[model samples]
Target: MNPKNPYKIALVLLSLFLFGCKDSASIPSEEDLNAREQTPQEESNQRTTGPIDYGYGPGLLPLGDEKISNEPKIGFIYSCDTQLNGGGAFKAGEWINESEGYWDPNKKIMVDGDISWANAQFTLETKGTTREIKGNGLPINHNTGTYPISTQDEAYLYDRNPNSIKEQKVVLSLPVQPTLAATPRCASGMVAIALNGIAIFNGLDAGGKDAVAHEIQDQCDGHPQKDGQYHYHNLSNCLEDTPRDTEHSALVGYALDGFGLYGKKGENGKILTNADLDECHGHTHEIKWEGSLKNMYHYHATEEYPYTIGCFKGNINSENLSQPENNEKPSMGPPPTQP
Candidate 1:
């Protein structure tokens, strides 16, 4: 080979060796980004340490030693729409599937200008029958319920109006008249209200009998009752109202622990929203909630979640507390109306 050609080849080989030996920088790792994307637990801890002390709030002062109903029953008032299943079969959609639709803090389900009915079906379901116990005269029949009351008849008691809702109505019919005396009251000012926790634990159900109740937090322990039911505070104001807006957020009643209680049931559902994102940690974990796990009879508002005492009421928590003979009657109202 010629000397010049050999010299060029040797130079090219030297260049290639240099490039291969030199070190290259690596890309930034996920750990670095995670430091910026804070998790909900971290956020919760931060909120806890902040100025807002969520521990202390207005709670229903328990009156006296009461007992829960021996034969507790439950009822459900829901809206339905004709929908299609995967196999071309038509089915009725229940309100529980309308999670975002009903979780609205501003609206109320009213009927007959007295109480707003979230939907016409809610009026028919709850107007007559006790969700917890059956055969109380109020006709809560699923196949053929008779609730003629309508939004034309009732109105939302509380909306933007501050003073609209006062002591509201709650109809509960238990088997033994004596067992019906218990009414739910808030303990330590904290009602069974929750937003993030429920969003995370939504669709979780009890696996079997005596299984530990699944929830985001153990705040249920703070509740006045030993049953460990979680409920929201009731006020005369909207469920979204804070103590600053209203003097006291009355305790509503406990949120039931069941798959059907909240969340849209589906297979391979996408976790898109913030609530869905938080729930990813529990992926593939089945709903522990079964129909027979426990019998919880409670109530809330129809239009929106009841925030005030007069807007919604329940006899569940009170089942363990003693109510005066005169107050034993179900707290019924003229029907909810919107101002």
Candidate 2:
């Protein structure tokens, strides 16, 4: 063979090798790229950093682990002040009928707003042995906080209550003279009806947490549930007859057991505390009963946890009871949004 011919052969071999390399170096396909395992850093980079979902509505998330007690909380006791979600306290202030347009998580005080209902009604009467309480469940005495908290309002960030304050057909016939049961029974759902015609739920919210502390309320300390039934978790300061210093608190409402629920004062006009009462948040004493003072077992409202009835001191008339929309069990999730 000629020398130049040999050189040409070598060049051809080199060219073939280069061409094979070029073919093997082709770019990977989209599927192959996606199939590869991602590194830790890359995986993190691909994830979105946003607010966590705690199975709660806007602003309804507790600041810490929720303080939920198992059912049969009849004798279970806890402090209301400590159950707060670190959100803030609802303080007494001028009514905020309009939205404020911003939410502040660090806000230490929660302001009140007005929720108007045109046909507010309530009545209390005693006929024979039955004390008939009737009303369209609306706060007839004072204005309530706006419901379905408007996105325009700052409270929306904390509580997006989607229900409106609709009137409920409430007619509860309780015994005029309730007698104590052999054993106190656990109470839930609509435990009582405020004198103003609003439903008074037990101290627990739907999630079994301290309702008054975790949930936001109107200036009147009232909010509506899923059924549009206006209700309270604690005694509303807006009640018709709240007695002052040295006077026994007036009869603000009655428990499902048909026992009168008095204000936060005991005899001799002393503001009561959990220490002052029994596990049911009351004590047997001579209170103004049906127009005359008589000694009986009655519940009392306090500025503490389990603010109202802790347990039923008397036999409850389940048939006459107006159950909450979610009456069977405490709701595990947040309330649904308004339609």
Candidate 3:
């Protein structure tokens, strides 16, 4: 109250300074604010170390009476005019974000309290002319989005995935040198196994719709089925290391017919479009095969519909293909409603 009272003024100023400091402490720092904005799945993805185990017990189910031959006849050849609900095909400009209202790469639900596989395993062995691929069906190299979309996650509003990822007994006896079949066959069921030890399914969803365009997937572009088998409907960019501008995309997986599946880039580092590939979503060209550059038939992933394989270009052993048990059948009646 007294302007000339220096001691009182000093006391008041010190109190104000201490109050300001307390208020500032209550206000979060920039780094703390940034961390608060990130979701649990986002935080899990930042990990650079090996897979994390969040105490989800180790229990794997057996592949039951599901047979590849039992799957309904829903296979088809790829075409540019392939009609997809929500949108015809994925273009480079379109991306998964909050505004899209369908899919978001940044937003992911958790699966069994895990964002990545905790017990990943895979191995490829060659003996004489046959190559044996074995694994517990889990992604060995990268991470996955959560499953059974948590009610709190924004992604849950779009896709309420009710399945949790689980390990499976997977064994495939493929050929070291696969030969083209006399006639291309429609691919169905578990069509391929990625290098990371995950399954690669065909493009169709349970309703015969374009799975890539309709269904919501994790940041790694994967989701689990009812059987808890985590698989990919399209190419996940995390599958391979970034290819140099001069390098061709690396082999990411192997189709049921023993043909190699490559990434987006083709010859001369060109991002391939539908026009660049055949009806089977593949082309014959010289590529590094078994340590030597040789001309071979192989499939390629694109941004469009039928993103991976369109049809089987090589001989496939149905016995070697492990089908999903109690696989959801495509609706024979009217088209089901979309989310």
Candidate 4:
């Protein structure tokens, strides 16, 4: 890096071209080097790295049943103990027991261990010329207690008897084809959902504090709120990383407005920063869509502030998707103010 030694600079470039730094456990990927050299506004020839999924990526993957079933089944989950989920040893459309929530290693009792165990559905709503993908806000992941949630100064637990988790009628409707809006909208609570049917929330906690910064989350960086609804304030990195080329970003979920939500970095193992994103934390470029290449606008999560998304690039059906109980405003740990 010494300017006085031209050979040294040449050696550095040559080394990069031939081989990345030797000290790291892995070498820098080709795309990583290129993205670093270019600024976000500099017009990227860079494309998303993955084949188009038959369904959508992450949140909306597997369009519908790849094939229809003739089995005589009225409902999915069979009993009060059964839960519908596509994560953690359960495949898509499978039901498993969700009674035991996370263990309190210290107290040795299950926390947030509650479920309404009810039927949920997603249907297309068409009235006049409008279309939407509508369904309840209930998650298949059993709502677990995150009571005694720790904050900067104190930990607060909700009154379990009065505040309990229940099936929420949340409707989601996004255009089969999405269009970018002229302005970005704030991502409040319950901004989206994951493929597993879990809730995806905004980056801010009830107090506008960085939720990811202070909340004590389980392995997926998710926890239940006072009402026992489990959700994420960040990408959570919970989904198992599927295989793709080195420069590819994994689809994690979707924003309520129907935009694709991608993982924390570019294919090259580089940590994507806010600098690489717009005010809504996204960009437009070539992406793999339904097994083919399509140029489109999508959001990418960063490791920094507003880790998931800063705003929405497309119009959102807030009333349809926002958690009804959340309208009362969530807590910021005893400060007690409406958001």
For residues 49-148, what per-residue lDDT tens digits would candidate 2 score against the true structure? 1142223333222221243333334224332223323222222112211133222222222334544555676566668999777778876545566665
Estimate, for each residue in 223-272, the C-alpha lDDT of model 3 and write its tens digit: 77777888887776445422254456767788988988887777776767
lDDT of each: 0.18, 0.55, 0.56, 0.43
Candidate 4 matches the true fold with a TM-score of 0.53
Candidate 1 structure quality by residue, lDDT tens digits, 1-339:
000000011221122111100113121122331122211110011101112212222211111011111222121111011110111001111211132222211121222221321211111112223323111111111111112222232121211111121121222222211112233222111222222111111111121100011111111111111122222222111112111221211112223211111221112322111122111111122222111222332222221111111111233334422211100111133334336
Which pairs of residues have clashing backbones in candidate 3? 109-146, 110-146, 110-147, 111-146, 111-147
Instruction: Flag regions of model 1 displaced more than 4 Å.
Output: 1-102, 113-233, 238-339
Q: What's the residue-level lDDT of 216 in candidate 1?
A: 10
User: Backbone clashes in each candidate structure, one number apiece?
Assistant: 71, 4, 5, 9
Error of 2 at 157 (Å): 1.2
lDDT per residue for candidate 4 within 1-339, as digits (tens), equals 000000011222223222111112233233333332211111122212223222323211111111111221111101111111111111111111113211111111112322233454333443443444444544332223343333221223221122334455555666646678776664555766654356777655443334444343443455655565666666643342323335446555667777778766554545565556776777777666433466788877654445566666787666545553222123332333435
Clash pairs, candidate 4, are 52-291, 55-63, 111-145, 112-144, 112-145, 136-170, 137-170, 247-267, 248-267
Model 3 CA deviation exceeding 4 Å by range: 1-114, 325-339
* CA-only RMSD, every prediction: 27.4, 31.1, 19.6, 20.3
